[model samples]
Target: MQQIILQPQTPDELRLVKQFAKVMKIKATTIKETPKARKKREILDGIERGLAEIKLHQEGKITLKTAQQVLDEL
Candidate 1:
């Protein structure tokens, strides 16, 4: 293994070195996907709403003709 030392001459250079070190440390760490419970709940709610819409269309609560007309207006 090889070791390198960085010596910043100016205040701006020191700040830049510190920022670079922080970015390097973050990049070296393993990233994990950990969704919060609230986020999970929101995703599930969105899915349920989509299913309800489908059910309403199937039951003729929302006519396909009206849906097509609305979509065409967009």
Candidate 2:
């Protein structure tokens, strides 16, 4: 079975979608994440990864690019 994800812009639209899903015998699950919440999640994830990389670099397990290298790449 194929699954679909919907982002309803309004509460009424969300209700309508859920109702349609119910009438179609489809399972409707609500997963809430506002734009701000998603952005915060992404930032936290990036910070976690950066910390992990720093730990690895300190342990001599990985080499990170220098500022010049990063700038050159950009």
Name the candidate that leads on lDDT: 2
Give the whole-model CA lDDT for all candidates, comma-separated.
0.71, 0.95
- Per-candidate TM-scores read 0.38, 0.58
For model 1, residues 1-74, the per-residue Cα lDDT tens digits are: 65555656687986787788797883322223367855896899999998898899999898455677889999
Model 1 regions lying over 4 Å from their true place:
1-35, 64-74
- Model 2, 51-72: lDDT tens digits are 9999999999999999999999
Q: Which candidate is the best by TM-score?
A: 2
lDDT of 1: 0.71
Model 2 ranges off by over 4 Å: 1-31
Pull out the clashing pairs in model 1: none
Which lDDT value does model 1 have at 72? 92
The number of residue pairs in model 2 that clash at the backbone is 0
